[model samples]
Target: MSPHSPARRRTAIGALAGTALVIPFLAAAPAQAAPCHLSGSTGSCNGTVHQPGSPGEGGGSGGNSGGGSGPVAPPAPVGLNPNQGQGFVQVPGNQAPPPPAKPATADLVAQAQAAAAFPVPIVHTAPKGKTFVRLRTSLWVDGFHVVKTQPITVGAQTVQLTGEPATVTWDLGEATRTCDNAGSEDGKACSYTYQRSSAGQPGGAYQITATIRWNVTWSCEGADCDEAGGDLGQQPMQSEATPLVVGEIQTTTGQ
Candidate 1:
Protein backbone atom coordinates (compact mmCIF):
# COMPACT_ATOMS: atom_id res chain seq x y z
CA MET A 1 0.00 0.00 0.00
CA SER A 2 1.96 2.97 -1.32
CA PRO A 3 0.91 6.38 0.03
CA HIS A 4 0.00 7.75 -3.42
CA SER A 5 -1.12 4.73 -5.33
CA PRO A 6 -3.36 5.22 -8.45
CA ALA A 7 -6.34 3.48 -6.94
CA ARG A 8 -5.99 5.45 -3.65
CA ARG A 9 -5.59 8.77 -5.62
CA ARG A 10 -8.70 8.03 -7.70
CA THR A 11 -10.65 7.17 -4.53
CA ALA A 12 -9.46 10.43 -2.82
CA ILE A 13 -10.62 12.55 -5.87
CA GLY A 14 -14.08 10.91 -5.84
CA ALA A 15 -14.32 11.54 -2.07
CA LEU A 16 -13.40 15.24 -2.52
CA ALA A 17 -16.10 15.73 -5.21
CA GLY A 18 -18.66 14.11 -2.95
CA THR A 19 -17.66 16.31 0.04
CA ALA A 20 -17.91 19.46 -2.16
CA LEU A 21 -21.49 18.58 -3.16
CA VAL A 22 -22.51 17.83 0.46
CA ILE A 23 -20.80 21.02 1.85
CA PRO A 24 -23.17 23.36 -0.01
CA PHE A 25 -26.28 21.54 1.32
CA LEU A 26 -24.88 21.53 4.86
CA ALA A 27 -24.27 25.32 4.71
CA ALA A 28 -27.96 25.90 3.62
CA ALA A 29 -29.44 23.69 6.37
CA PRO A 30 -31.96 25.57 8.55
CA ALA A 31 -31.11 26.30 12.22
CA GLN A 32 -33.40 25.45 15.16
CA ALA A 33 -36.34 27.97 15.14
CA ALA A 34 -36.58 30.24 18.16
CA PRO A 35 -39.76 30.04 20.29
CA CYS A 36 -42.12 32.72 19.01
CA HIS A 37 -42.84 35.48 21.51
CA LEU A 38 -46.07 37.60 21.19
CA SER A 39 -46.32 41.30 21.88
CA GLY A 40 -49.90 42.60 21.50
CA SER A 41 -51.31 41.69 18.08
CA THR A 42 -47.83 40.95 16.54
CA GLY A 43 -45.14 38.32 17.09
CA SER A 44 -41.31 38.49 17.11
CA CYS A 45 -38.53 35.96 16.59
CA ASN A 46 -34.91 35.96 17.84
CA GLY A 47 -33.81 35.51 14.20
CA THR A 48 -34.23 37.97 11.33
CA VAL A 49 -37.29 36.22 9.86
CA HIS A 50 -39.57 39.20 9.34
CA GLN A 51 -43.23 39.12 8.26
CA PRO A 52 -43.83 39.87 4.55
CA GLY A 53 -45.10 43.38 3.65
CA SER A 54 -44.86 44.54 7.27
CA PRO A 55 -44.55 48.32 7.91
CA GLY A 56 -40.96 49.67 8.00
CA GLU A 57 -39.67 46.20 6.91
CA GLY A 58 -38.96 45.04 3.36
CA GLY A 59 -39.77 41.50 2.25
CA GLY A 60 -42.02 41.12 -0.84
CA SER A 61 -42.34 42.82 -4.26
CA GLY A 62 -45.13 45.41 -4.23
CA GLY A 63 -46.48 47.14 -1.12
CA ASN A 64 -45.81 49.98 1.33
CA SER A 65 -42.53 48.70 2.64
CA GLY A 66 -41.53 51.34 5.20
CA GLY A 67 -44.63 53.35 6.20
CA GLY A 68 -48.12 52.36 7.45
CA SER A 69 -51.08 52.98 5.16
CA GLY A 70 -52.02 56.64 5.11
CA PRO A 71 -54.29 57.45 7.99
CA VAL A 72 -57.71 55.97 7.10
CA ALA A 73 -59.76 58.88 5.94
CA PRO A 74 -62.67 59.55 8.30
CA PRO A 75 -66.19 59.20 6.90
CA ALA A 76 -67.81 62.39 5.73
CA PRO A 77 -70.35 63.84 8.17
CA VAL A 78 -74.05 63.87 7.23
CA GLY A 79 -76.84 66.49 7.38
CA LEU A 80 -74.40 69.34 7.64
CA ASN A 81 -75.72 72.86 7.77
CA PRO A 82 -74.31 74.98 4.97
CA ASN A 83 -75.00 78.33 6.60
CA GLN A 84 -73.19 77.47 9.78
CA GLY A 85 -69.87 75.66 9.37
CA GLN A 86 -70.60 73.20 12.12
CA GLY A 87 -71.35 69.54 12.40
CA PHE A 88 -74.87 68.25 12.02
CA VAL A 89 -77.06 68.93 15.01
CA GLN A 90 -78.56 65.76 16.38
CA VAL A 91 -82.23 65.86 17.28
CA PRO A 92 -83.50 64.00 20.29
CA GLY A 93 -84.51 60.50 19.29
CA ASN A 94 -87.71 60.53 21.30
CA GLN A 95 -88.88 63.99 20.20
CA ALA A 96 -91.01 64.49 17.12
CA PRO A 97 -91.70 67.47 14.86
CA PRO A 98 -94.66 69.60 15.88
CA PRO A 99 -97.75 69.56 13.69
CA PRO A 100 -98.70 72.47 11.46
CA ALA A 101 -100.61 75.23 13.21
CA LYS A 102 -104.39 75.27 12.82
CA PRO A 103 -106.00 78.03 10.85
CA ALA A 104 -107.40 81.06 12.65
CA THR A 105 -111.07 81.23 13.57
CA ALA A 106 -111.67 84.32 11.46
CA ASP A 107 -109.92 82.70 8.53
CA LEU A 108 -112.10 79.62 8.85
CA VAL A 109 -115.19 81.76 8.96
CA ALA A 110 -114.15 83.66 5.87
CA GLN A 111 -113.57 80.37 4.05
CA ALA A 112 -117.06 79.24 4.98
CA GLN A 113 -118.54 82.51 3.78
CA ALA A 114 -116.74 82.20 0.48
CA ALA A 115 -117.99 78.63 -0.01
CA ALA A 116 -121.59 79.30 1.07
CA ALA A 117 -124.10 79.97 -1.71
CA PHE A 118 -127.09 81.01 0.33
CA PRO A 119 -129.94 82.30 -1.77
CA VAL A 120 -132.33 85.07 -0.81
CA PRO A 121 -135.51 83.92 0.84
CA ILE A 122 -138.64 84.34 -1.28
CA VAL A 123 -141.42 86.46 0.21
CA HIS A 124 -144.53 84.27 0.14
CA THR A 125 -147.19 86.87 0.94
CA ALA A 126 -149.40 88.67 -1.60
CA PRO A 127 -147.79 91.88 -2.77
CA LYS A 128 -151.02 93.68 -3.80
CA GLY A 129 -153.34 92.71 -0.95
CA LYS A 130 -155.47 94.99 1.16
CA THR A 131 -154.12 96.04 4.54
CA PHE A 132 -155.62 96.79 8.03
CA VAL A 133 -156.12 93.08 8.62
CA ARG A 134 -153.81 90.60 10.31
CA LEU A 135 -151.91 89.90 7.10
CA ARG A 136 -149.85 86.76 7.24
CA THR A 137 -146.29 86.93 5.86
CA SER A 138 -143.77 84.19 5.27
CA LEU A 139 -140.47 83.29 3.48
CA TRP A 140 -139.21 80.15 1.84
CA VAL A 141 -135.76 79.01 0.71
CA ASP A 142 -136.01 76.88 -2.42
CA GLY A 143 -133.55 74.06 -1.71
CA PHE A 144 -132.23 74.64 1.79
CA HIS A 145 -133.25 72.80 4.95
CA VAL A 146 -133.13 73.87 8.60
CA VAL A 147 -129.45 72.97 8.65
CA LYS A 148 -127.02 72.86 5.75
CA THR A 149 -123.42 71.68 5.51
CA GLN A 150 -120.62 72.66 3.12
CA PRO A 151 -116.95 71.81 2.85
CA ILE A 152 -114.32 74.53 2.46
CA THR A 153 -110.55 74.73 2.28
CA VAL A 154 -108.30 77.39 3.74
CA GLY A 155 -104.60 77.15 2.92
CA ALA A 156 -103.77 73.47 3.34
CA GLN A 157 -106.52 72.54 5.76
CA THR A 158 -110.09 71.44 4.93
CA VAL A 159 -113.10 72.09 7.12
CA GLN A 160 -116.90 71.79 7.16
CA LEU A 161 -119.43 74.54 7.84
CA THR A 162 -123.05 74.31 8.94
CA GLY A 163 -125.47 77.13 8.18
CA GLU A 164 -129.09 77.84 9.01
CA PRO A 165 -131.54 80.74 8.94
CA ALA A 166 -131.73 82.32 12.34
CA THR A 167 -134.43 84.89 11.79
CA VAL A 168 -136.44 86.78 9.15
CA THR A 169 -136.70 90.52 9.76
CA TRP A 170 -139.51 92.50 8.18
CA ASP A 171 -139.36 96.23 7.42
CA LEU A 172 -142.87 97.45 6.58
CA GLY A 173 -141.55 100.81 5.34
CA GLU A 174 -142.80 102.06 8.67
CA ALA A 175 -141.17 100.01 11.47
CA THR A 176 -139.21 96.79 11.78
CA ARG A 177 -140.03 93.37 13.22
CA THR A 178 -138.29 89.99 13.35
CA CYS A 179 -139.77 86.48 12.94
CA ASP A 180 -137.93 83.62 14.63
CA ASN A 181 -140.18 80.74 13.69
CA ALA A 182 -141.09 78.73 10.60
CA GLY A 183 -144.32 79.32 8.73
CA SER A 184 -147.11 76.90 7.74
CA GLU A 185 -148.57 76.44 4.29
CA ASP A 186 -151.62 78.55 5.22
CA GLY A 187 -149.78 81.60 6.63
CA LYS A 188 -146.59 82.90 8.17
CA ALA A 189 -145.44 82.37 11.73
CA CYS A 190 -145.41 86.17 12.11
CA SER A 191 -148.11 88.57 10.96
CA TYR A 192 -148.57 92.33 11.19
CA THR A 193 -151.91 94.08 11.54
CA TYR A 194 -152.19 97.46 9.86
CA GLN A 195 -153.42 100.33 11.94
CA ARG A 196 -155.02 102.15 9.03
CA SER A 197 -155.23 101.95 5.24
CA SER A 198 -152.30 102.54 2.85
CA ALA A 199 -154.38 105.29 1.19
CA GLY A 200 -152.38 107.98 2.99
CA GLN A 201 -149.03 106.38 2.37
CA PRO A 202 -146.87 107.45 -0.60
CA GLY A 203 -147.74 105.80 -3.96
CA GLY A 204 -150.92 104.44 -2.34
CA ALA A 205 -148.92 101.41 -1.09
CA TYR A 206 -146.42 100.39 1.56
CA GLN A 207 -142.98 98.98 0.81
CA ILE A 208 -142.36 95.72 2.64
CA THR A 209 -138.79 94.40 3.01
CA ALA A 210 -137.84 90.92 4.17
CA THR A 211 -134.37 90.19 5.42
CA ILE A 212 -132.89 86.83 6.49
CA ARG A 213 -130.19 86.27 9.08
CA TRP A 214 -127.88 83.28 8.73
CA ASN A 215 -126.02 81.45 11.51
CA VAL A 216 -122.87 79.54 10.63
CA THR A 217 -120.69 77.03 12.43
CA TRP A 218 -117.50 75.28 11.36
CA SER A 219 -115.20 72.37 12.27
CA CYS A 220 -111.97 70.85 10.96
CA GLU A 221 -112.42 67.90 8.64
CA GLY A 222 -111.57 64.60 10.33
CA ALA A 223 -110.58 66.43 13.49
CA ASP A 224 -112.07 68.22 16.49
CA CYS A 225 -114.22 71.34 16.20
CA ASP A 226 -112.40 74.61 16.09
CA GLU A 227 -113.23 78.09 17.40
CA ALA A 228 -115.44 78.68 14.35
CA GLY A 229 -117.90 76.14 15.80
CA GLY A 230 -120.94 77.06 17.89
CA ASP A 231 -122.32 80.30 16.58
CA LEU A 232 -119.69 81.56 14.17
CA GLY A 233 -121.75 84.73 14.08
CA GLN A 234 -124.44 85.84 11.63
CA GLN A 235 -124.76 87.40 8.18
CA PRO A 236 -127.81 89.30 6.95
CA MET A 237 -129.31 88.92 3.50
CA GLN A 238 -132.29 90.93 2.22
CA SER A 239 -134.74 90.77 -0.63
CA GLU A 240 -136.21 93.55 -2.76
CA ALA A 241 -139.09 95.49 -1.28
CA THR A 242 -142.68 94.67 -2.28
CA PRO A 243 -145.81 96.83 -2.55
CA LEU A 244 -149.02 96.35 -0.59
CA VAL A 245 -152.27 98.27 -0.87
CA VAL A 246 -154.74 99.02 1.90
CA GLY A 247 -158.39 100.13 1.81
CA GLU A 248 -160.70 101.59 4.47
CA ILE A 249 -164.33 100.66 5.00
CA GLN A 250 -166.79 103.09 3.35
CA THR A 251 -169.86 104.50 5.05
CA THR A 252 -172.97 105.78 3.24
CA THR A 253 -175.89 107.77 4.75
CA GLY A 254 -179.32 108.08 3.05
CA GLN A 255 -181.53 111.20 3.60
Candidate 2:
Protein backbone atom coordinates (compact mmCIF):
# COMPACT_ATOMS: atom_id res chain seq x y z
CA MET A 1 0.00 0.00 0.00
CA SER A 2 1.15 3.62 0.70
CA PRO A 3 4.94 3.99 1.12
CA HIS A 4 4.46 5.76 4.51
CA SER A 5 1.89 4.82 6.91
CA PRO A 6 -1.49 6.68 6.48
CA ALA A 7 -1.58 8.01 10.07
CA ARG A 8 1.75 9.87 9.64
CA ARG A 9 0.67 11.54 6.40
CA ARG A 10 -2.61 12.53 7.98
CA THR A 11 -0.81 14.10 10.95
CA ALA A 12 1.48 16.18 8.64
CA ILE A 13 -1.44 17.68 6.65
CA GLY A 14 -3.33 18.50 9.88
CA ALA A 15 -0.34 20.54 11.26
CA LEU A 16 -0.03 22.58 7.95
CA ALA A 17 -3.76 23.42 7.97
CA GLY A 18 -3.75 24.53 11.61
CA THR A 19 -0.73 26.89 11.02
CA ALA A 20 -2.44 28.60 8.03
CA LEU A 21 -5.66 29.19 10.00
CA VAL A 22 -3.85 30.70 13.03
CA ILE A 23 -1.73 33.07 10.83
CA PRO A 24 -4.84 34.52 9.08
CA PHE A 25 -6.68 35.14 12.40
CA LEU A 26 -3.67 37.00 13.84
CA ALA A 27 -3.39 39.26 10.73
CA ALA A 28 -7.12 40.17 10.85
CA ALA A 29 -7.23 41.02 14.56
CA PRO A 30 -7.29 44.96 14.36
CA ALA A 31 -3.59 45.91 13.97
CA GLN A 32 -1.92 48.07 16.80
CA ALA A 33 -1.41 50.88 14.26
CA ALA A 34 -1.68 54.54 15.59
CA PRO A 35 -5.34 55.72 16.08
CA CYS A 36 -6.93 57.23 12.89
CA HIS A 37 -6.38 61.03 12.91
CA LEU A 38 -5.83 64.12 10.72
CA SER A 39 -2.28 65.39 11.11
CA GLY A 40 -1.90 68.63 9.26
CA SER A 41 -2.31 67.88 5.54
CA THR A 42 -1.72 64.11 5.92
CA GLY A 43 -3.79 61.40 7.56
CA SER A 44 -2.20 59.25 10.30
CA CYS A 45 -3.36 56.03 11.99
CA ASN A 46 -2.07 57.10 15.44
CA GLY A 47 -3.53 60.67 15.23
CA THR A 48 -7.10 61.78 16.03
CA VAL A 49 -9.61 62.06 13.11
CA HIS A 50 -11.66 65.28 13.13
CA GLN A 51 -15.38 64.94 12.50
CA PRO A 52 -18.74 66.55 13.28
CA GLY A 53 -19.95 64.38 16.13
CA SER A 54 -23.19 62.56 15.44
CA PRO A 55 -26.12 63.82 17.51
CA GLY A 56 -25.51 62.81 21.12
CA GLU A 57 -22.47 60.91 19.94
CA GLY A 58 -20.39 61.86 23.02
CA GLY A 59 -21.72 65.35 22.03
CA GLY A 60 -18.60 66.25 20.03
CA SER A 61 -16.36 65.68 23.05
CA GLY A 62 -12.98 64.50 21.78
CA GLY A 63 -14.23 64.96 18.17
CA ASN A 64 -12.66 67.90 16.40
CA SER A 65 -10.06 69.10 18.92
CA GLY A 66 -8.79 71.86 16.55
CA GLY A 67 -8.16 75.36 17.84
CA GLY A 68 -10.35 78.13 16.25
CA SER A 69 -8.80 81.09 14.57
CA GLY A 70 -9.12 84.60 15.99
CA PRO A 71 -11.72 87.05 14.54
CA VAL A 72 -10.63 89.04 11.47
CA ALA A 73 -11.25 92.79 11.75
CA PRO A 74 -12.63 94.77 8.74
CA PRO A 75 -10.52 97.52 7.05
CA ALA A 76 -11.08 101.16 8.06
CA PRO A 77 -13.86 103.07 6.25
CA VAL A 78 -13.20 105.86 3.71
CA GLY A 79 -15.25 108.95 2.48
CA LEU A 80 -16.89 111.78 4.58
CA ASN A 81 -16.51 109.88 7.83
CA PRO A 82 -12.81 109.14 7.07
CA ASN A 83 -9.98 109.90 9.53
CA GLN A 84 -8.44 113.35 8.97
CA GLY A 85 -5.98 113.40 11.86
CA GLN A 86 -3.00 112.64 9.66
CA GLY A 87 -1.66 115.56 7.55
CA PHE A 88 -2.06 119.26 6.77
CA VAL A 89 -3.68 120.71 3.62
CA GLN A 90 -1.76 123.29 1.51
CA VAL A 91 -3.11 126.63 0.13
CA PRO A 92 -1.80 128.99 -2.60
CA GLY A 93 0.40 131.91 -1.39
CA ASN A 94 -1.44 134.46 -3.53
CA GLN A 95 -4.84 133.70 -2.02
CA ALA A 96 -4.80 136.59 0.49
CA PRO A 97 -7.73 138.96 1.20
CA PRO A 98 -7.94 142.15 -0.88
CA PRO A 99 -6.74 145.54 0.53
CA PRO A 100 -9.09 148.31 1.69
CA ALA A 101 -10.21 151.06 -0.74
CA LYS A 102 -8.67 154.59 -0.76
CA PRO A 103 -10.51 157.85 -0.05
CA ALA A 104 -12.89 159.03 -2.84
CA THR A 105 -12.60 162.38 -4.69
CA ALA A 106 -15.74 163.77 -3.06
CA ASP A 107 -14.40 162.93 0.40
CA LEU A 108 -11.09 164.68 -0.34
CA VAL A 109 -12.91 167.79 -1.61
CA ALA A 110 -15.06 167.93 1.51
CA GLN A 111 -11.96 167.73 3.70
CA ALA A 112 -10.33 170.62 1.79
CA GLN A 113 -13.46 172.75 2.18
CA ALA A 114 -13.58 172.15 5.90
CA ALA A 115 -9.91 173.13 6.26
CA ALA A 116 -10.46 176.37 4.28
CA ALA A 117 -13.50 177.35 6.37
CA PHE A 118 -11.42 177.96 9.51
CA PRO A 119 -7.87 179.22 9.13
CA VAL A 120 -5.28 179.77 11.86
CA PRO A 121 -4.95 183.34 13.10
CA ILE A 122 -1.80 185.26 12.15
CA VAL A 123 0.68 185.84 15.00
CA HIS A 124 3.43 188.39 15.81
CA THR A 125 7.06 187.26 15.70
CA ALA A 126 10.51 188.99 15.85
CA PRO A 127 14.19 188.48 16.47
CA LYS A 128 16.16 189.92 19.46
CA GLY A 129 19.48 191.82 19.41
CA LYS A 130 21.70 194.42 21.11
CA THR A 131 22.15 198.09 20.00
CA PHE A 132 18.98 197.42 17.97
CA VAL A 133 15.27 196.74 18.61
CA ARG A 134 12.47 195.28 16.44
CA LEU A 135 8.68 195.72 16.26
CA ARG A 136 7.02 192.30 16.43
CA THR A 137 3.47 193.23 17.37
CA SER A 138 0.65 192.72 14.79
CA LEU A 139 -0.63 196.26 15.36
CA TRP A 140 -1.65 198.29 12.31
CA VAL A 141 0.92 200.97 11.35
CA ASP A 142 1.57 203.48 8.54
CA GLY A 143 5.21 202.93 7.44
CA PHE A 144 7.97 200.56 8.51
CA HIS A 145 11.59 199.62 7.63
CA VAL A 146 14.43 197.49 9.04
CA VAL A 147 17.31 199.72 10.25
CA LYS A 148 20.89 198.98 11.11
CA THR A 149 23.99 201.06 12.06
CA GLN A 150 27.57 200.62 13.31
CA PRO A 151 27.44 202.85 16.42
CA ILE A 152 23.88 202.10 17.62
CA THR A 153 23.16 203.12 21.21
CA VAL A 154 21.65 200.28 23.27
CA GLY A 155 20.86 202.33 26.39
CA ALA A 156 17.60 204.27 26.99
CA GLN A 157 16.89 207.38 24.83
CA THR A 158 15.17 210.75 25.30
CA VAL A 159 11.94 209.90 23.39
CA GLN A 160 11.57 206.16 24.40
CA LEU A 161 12.87 203.33 26.56
CA THR A 162 16.48 202.44 25.71
CA GLY A 163 18.26 199.08 25.75
CA GLU A 164 17.20 195.98 23.75
CA PRO A 165 13.70 196.24 25.25
CA ALA A 166 10.69 194.58 23.56
CA THR A 167 9.29 197.96 22.50
CA VAL A 168 11.28 200.50 20.52
CA THR A 169 11.93 204.07 21.73
CA TRP A 170 10.56 207.13 19.88
CA ASP A 171 14.05 208.35 18.96
CA LEU A 172 15.33 205.01 17.60
CA GLY A 173 18.34 204.86 15.21
CA GLU A 174 20.02 208.21 14.39
CA ALA A 175 17.80 210.64 12.46
CA THR A 176 19.02 210.90 8.87
CA ARG A 177 16.86 213.85 7.72
CA THR A 178 13.61 215.75 8.39
CA CYS A 179 11.39 217.48 5.83
CA ASP A 180 8.12 219.50 6.07
CA ASN A 181 5.19 220.00 3.64
CA ALA A 182 4.76 223.67 2.63
CA GLY A 183 2.23 226.04 0.91
CA SER A 184 -0.69 223.54 1.00
CA GLU A 185 -4.00 224.50 2.62
CA ASP A 186 -4.64 220.82 3.48
CA GLY A 187 -1.07 220.50 4.80
CA LYS A 188 -0.81 216.77 3.88
CA ALA A 189 2.70 216.32 2.33
CA CYS A 190 4.91 216.26 5.47
CA SER A 191 7.20 213.25 5.98
CA TYR A 192 10.25 212.38 8.18
CA THR A 193 13.19 210.34 6.86
CA TYR A 194 14.64 207.33 8.73
CA GLN A 195 16.95 204.53 7.57
CA ARG A 196 17.13 200.73 8.14
CA SER A 197 20.31 198.77 8.77
CA SER A 198 19.58 195.87 6.51
CA ALA A 199 16.94 194.68 4.07
CA GLY A 200 16.99 191.43 6.01
CA GLN A 201 16.36 188.18 4.17
CA PRO A 202 13.47 188.79 1.73
CA GLY A 203 10.09 187.25 2.57
CA GLY A 204 10.50 188.46 6.15
CA ALA A 205 8.19 191.08 7.67
CA TYR A 206 9.47 194.32 9.24
CA GLN A 207 8.21 197.63 10.68
CA ILE A 208 9.50 200.85 12.23
CA THR A 209 7.66 203.12 14.69
CA ALA A 210 9.50 206.20 15.84
CA THR A 211 8.49 209.36 17.70
CA ILE A 212 10.55 212.30 16.52
CA ARG A 213 11.28 215.81 17.80
CA TRP A 214 10.53 217.84 14.67
CA ASN A 215 9.80 221.54 14.45
CA VAL A 216 7.80 222.08 11.21
CA THR A 217 8.27 225.59 9.92
CA TRP A 218 4.73 225.54 8.46
CA SER A 219 1.88 223.19 7.53
CA CYS A 220 1.99 222.10 3.82
CA GLU A 221 0.29 220.10 1.04
CA GLY A 222 0.35 216.55 -0.47
CA ALA A 223 3.51 214.51 0.33
CA ASP A 224 5.73 217.64 0.25
CA CYS A 225 8.56 217.65 2.75
CA ASP A 226 9.79 221.19 2.24
CA GLU A 227 12.42 222.46 4.66
CA ALA A 228 11.29 226.05 4.05
CA GLY A 229 7.97 225.65 6.01
CA GLY A 230 7.25 227.04 9.50
CA ASP A 231 8.52 225.12 12.51
CA LEU A 232 6.52 221.88 12.80
CA GLY A 233 5.83 219.74 15.79
CA GLN A 234 7.74 216.49 16.19
CA GLN A 235 5.32 213.52 16.13
CA PRO A 236 5.34 209.72 15.99
CA MET A 237 5.27 208.07 12.56
CA GLN A 238 4.33 204.38 12.33
CA SER A 239 5.00 202.24 9.28
CA GLU A 240 2.81 199.68 7.55
CA ALA A 241 4.63 196.47 8.42
CA THR A 242 5.39 193.59 6.04
CA PRO A 243 4.95 190.03 7.24
CA LEU A 244 8.10 187.92 7.35
CA VAL A 245 8.27 184.14 7.29
CA VAL A 246 11.06 181.54 7.06
CA GLY A 247 10.75 181.61 3.29
CA GLU A 248 11.58 185.31 3.41
CA ILE A 249 15.12 184.57 4.59
CA GLN A 250 16.17 182.41 1.59
CA THR A 251 12.99 182.83 -0.48
CA THR A 252 12.48 179.10 -0.08
CA THR A 253 9.69 177.40 1.82
CA GLY A 254 11.64 175.70 4.54
CA GLN A 255 10.14 172.65 6.17
lDDT of each: 0.61, 0.32
Q: Tens digit of lDDT per residue, candidate 2, span 1-255?
A: 464989889988999999999999889667644234444534433353334454322354443443212234777775433435656433447476786554333333233323321111121222322112232212212222222112211122111111111222231223322322111112233322223333463433233333222221222222222221232222233333333322212246769
TM-score for each predicted model, relative to the true structure:
0.49, 0.18
**In model 2, which runs have C-alpha deviations exceeding 4 angstroms?**
1-4, 27-33, 37-51, 55-59, 65-255
Q: Which candidate's TM-score is highest?
A: 1
Task: In angstroms, give how far residue 196 of model 1 lies from its true place.
Answer: 2.0
Off by over 4 Å in 1: 1-106, 126-128, 132-144, 147-149, 154-157, 223-230
State the number of backbone clashes in model 2: 42
lDDT of 2: 0.32
